[model samples]
Target: MTDAESPANGSGVGAVRSHLESTISGTLESRNAGAFVHAGSRHDPTVRYCRVALGRRWPRERGREVVAVAFDGDEWLTASSDDASGHPAETLAVRLAERSGSNTILTPAAVPHDAALYLERAGLDLASTDVVARARATKTTAERDRIADAQAAASAGIRRAASLLADAAIDDGRLAADGDPITPNRLRTTIDEAIVSAGAFPAGTTVVNPDPEHAPSTLDGEGTANDGDTSEVPLRPGEPIVLETAPRGPDGYHAGLVRTLVVDSDGGRERRAHVGATQSFRSAAAMLTADAESVTSVEADLEAEVRAFGFGEGDDVRTRAFGVGLEPCERPFEGGDRIDPGSVVRLESAVHVDDGSWLRIADLLVSSEDGERAAYLEAPSRSLEPSALLE
Candidate 1:
């Protein structure tokens, strides 16, 4: 499961939680005397204010003692007031700040503008950009395991989709199973069901781009089959199909996978591009070692590898490498920030074909302790030979 999906046990917070505390403590120290006020729901994606404040999942009924213990004597405040007669959450937070002898309250940058204004008017100095995100970016060992589990589950979903494609029968220009032509919607439903059965949440929209050469403008709404009903199109042999899925495990961590495939067609050009993408992925993975200096350098190395394979970074080709954690695409790598050991990243390479078709491959890689090489979390073969899928 992803770290975001993983349930926090009753046990106190560990390394990641401690790092969050240290980050907030450091921020508080720099700003003089103040407490960090995290105002948000328990499920807020960006801040997860309650989790950070409590050092674990929020205990709904436990009163101030739990709060005091989690804070460890540090003056911290939370806007969890449900009492309508007393004060609104924001107003209560301001009052708590006043009583705690802290004149300032550090809030996350994701706070709504209205809430920020309220804090400002409460006679409390408000600082934006809390350390929660920074702490989240650098995951602990346990968090990495959760992410790995999520990635594994996502990979399982991809395998299930590939298996369906492999077993599908091509009749004329359409793909079918058991005498029924398969539609994109059917395929997506099957994929999502498989993902859920495999212990991961169904990714809302699994992109299924059939006939990549003449890809659809968008994947919104129910898919189309050949007849233009809800299922508007049918899978045609020889056409390159791009399948991308980002599934979240029960723990709330997300993992992504993208692969290009073809049925009975001659896959010479597509195979070449697939090989190029695989090679580029390897080259990028090599740069994720402990000694890697910066994300910019790694991206440059990846781009150079793609260029070496005769692919340009223009409209035809696309590449991405970023860290993955609570979110499918996490920070540092997303922001092109510095490289740190133990950061898990996903690297992708795609090359467009002359016919508007494209082949792409993506995999997860974790930085090594020495920062010289990365460990491949998912290293499936990238061969585009039809036999590979058929068998």
Candidate 2:
């Protein structure tokens, strides 16, 4: 490794702060923003882009990952939480934009007020153009690959969930493994282990809910509402268990996968709902495009597809698709933003059954440059039967 990228050098922020010469025209242009400023912790996309895209690294002691960063598409200035250089990370970050060729800085609303004041004090214009947000919504090929790798790990976690369900035996109507009633904590630990083994961090969250309709919502991929819900309720046979996991890859990209399975099913209402959810996934895959104008329209079609299968949609249970990447839900094109050609999305298809639960499946999806149709990054059976994952 080069000296700057090496962790042993203790170069701290200087290693990452480069004054590269680029064809930035050294003059303002009506094109993409010539300068961008962002501030967030390591999980933020700014750090990811700096680390992954720009091939930069922070010193080991200075690698706290939380930082205020500024860039002009080529040059970079950053200050981390570990900065002892007597310079405030936020102020240093905002000050660098003045040196950039651009007269204005494109920053999101999340900018720190103190740092923002630096721009104003320096007499530089501040444009709330969402430069970072826009770039994050549009994934480069490498970003998509990282997200897919994370999703593959996420899929492994879901597979582990299914394998556990398959191995559990019905003991007095409750799912049992090793003669102990399997609990949500056990399931979460197992799934998280599988995810880590597959080369991703389970930092996002792993949710194991026996009943999604009544369980706290996982619509945001955090499952924060159901922190310990249904922990005491032993999963019963014929009951549906929802496993939703969002794992971030080593490089800061993230992906989500959710699956619902039943142990020792009776082949009744649950089966129908499972089929409806699975079919909706297949149908949506057949229609998605890389440049879909309105993702909401595509989501509406999946809702209709689920309704056609004799399953009723519940107000609490939603069937939809949204962008996924640097965050579990990067949320692209939802607010009239154009769909990025290489963006990754999560397709969630769900149907509510009379059994007081909602059956659902979610997987990472992507469309090719051909713009014909989208497809799943990983293929696992959506069957309600636990053994389907093994198939």
Candidate 3:
């Protein structure tokens, strides 16, 4: 590398290291998110550490004594709130502003639905930018390590999820671990249990698409499948099963992976189709790394590949594979999207049919070399047939 490039890269790495240390130390006040604390533990000290980290990253435009507010907090009492009016809780921004003698406050884009109007009413100057969003999108070396572990955890979850389905398909209603009739509800129940065991939190979405009849967005959804039927659909001999697993690691990095499998019979046609689509996704991702193309370009490339693979053309294809770190789905994948070097992506090419089961084969990757190369969490299987379930 050139001397200039070396220093610049070094500085970026130093910045990430400094930020994480200070945040973990809890020397500063934070505004962007709930302070970093241990998982499932009640400790307010984490807040102080996060404040220091986030506060330091606060742009000078926010001015000294900058206050940052994370929309998702314990004090948030409502599932949804009017952002135009300040919520009832004592906001971090307000309190920090008063303490630091700063008049301006910044908020994450995920701020309440009416955040713009609400901040205006609070008598504080407010501005919105994806500064934090972009920063969080790219994964640092340390951050990527955490994400790698998280992705491994996700891979484990996917295997367990698929195993449960396979057991149900072959074992005449008998569960895999519990040895009971594997019902739809039971499949979800077992999956949740496995997620917890894997040391990750469960998202509301489903990574598995075993049947066309059951198209619930998330595996944990209690709502009936697309058909609105309660009848249980266990894994069958020739049915395609999509194993999609996304779980937040111990350090909060999201790792997402999807694999398509057929219980007893390898669906050759579906497997070949999935392989072709996955290759296209790999190509698009390669360009994303090489050219540092915006999310839009990546999305377009993926869509084009899907159409080439003989999937329906146009926007009808379900395609979005972008950054998923800190909070999953952190960036939108569309053409002309400016690139960030540290962003991690879960680029996916989903294959859905009209009233038939669809599948997704995806991998969580980190962008590097100024967006020229995408580093996978690990070597991902290019096809549905895993020599051994990926871990």
List model 1 lDDT by residue over 1-391, tens digit each.
3323335554424665666678778877776646665444445554352353345554444233211111212644444434334324456555655575677667677665655666667776767764667767666666677777777766666666677777789888788777877666666776677777778886574667633334431254334332233334676777777777778766566777777767776856676676667777777766665365466777667667767766655646677778776677766664357667767777777777756567777777777674356777753356564346324
Query: What would the TM-score be for candidate 3 when compared with the true structure?
Result: 0.66
Q: Estimate each model's TM-score.
A: 0.82, 0.82, 0.66
Ranking by lDDT: 2, 1, 3
The runs of at least 3 residues in candidate 2 whose Cα sits more than 4 Å from the true structure, single-residue gaps closed, are 1-28, 31-34, 58-66, 79-102, 210-229, 312-317, 333-335
Tens digit of lDDT per residue, candidate 3, span 321-373? 67676556666454455556666787777766435567667787677764357
RMSD of each predicted structure: 4.8, 5.7, 10.6
- Give the Å error, residue 208, model 3: 3.3
Question: Per-residue lDDT of 184-284 in model 2, one digit per residue for the tens?
Answer: 76788888999889978898478776343444333332354444455545677777788888888766677888888878777887676677777787777
Q: What is the TM-score of candidate 1?
A: 0.82
Between prediction 1 and prediction 2, the one with superior TM-score is: 1
The residue-level lDDT of candidate 1 at 371 comes to: 32
CA displacement after TM-score superposition, residue 73 of candidate 2 (Å):
5.1
The numbered model that scores best in lDDT is: 2
Error of 2 at 364 (Å): 0.8
* TM-score (C-alpha, index-matched) for candidate 2: 0.82
lDDT of every predicted structure (CA atoms): 0.62, 0.65, 0.52
Model 3 stretches astray by more than 4 angstroms: 1-14, 17-124, 163-190, 205-207, 210-231, 266-268, 310-316, 332-335, 370-372, 379-382
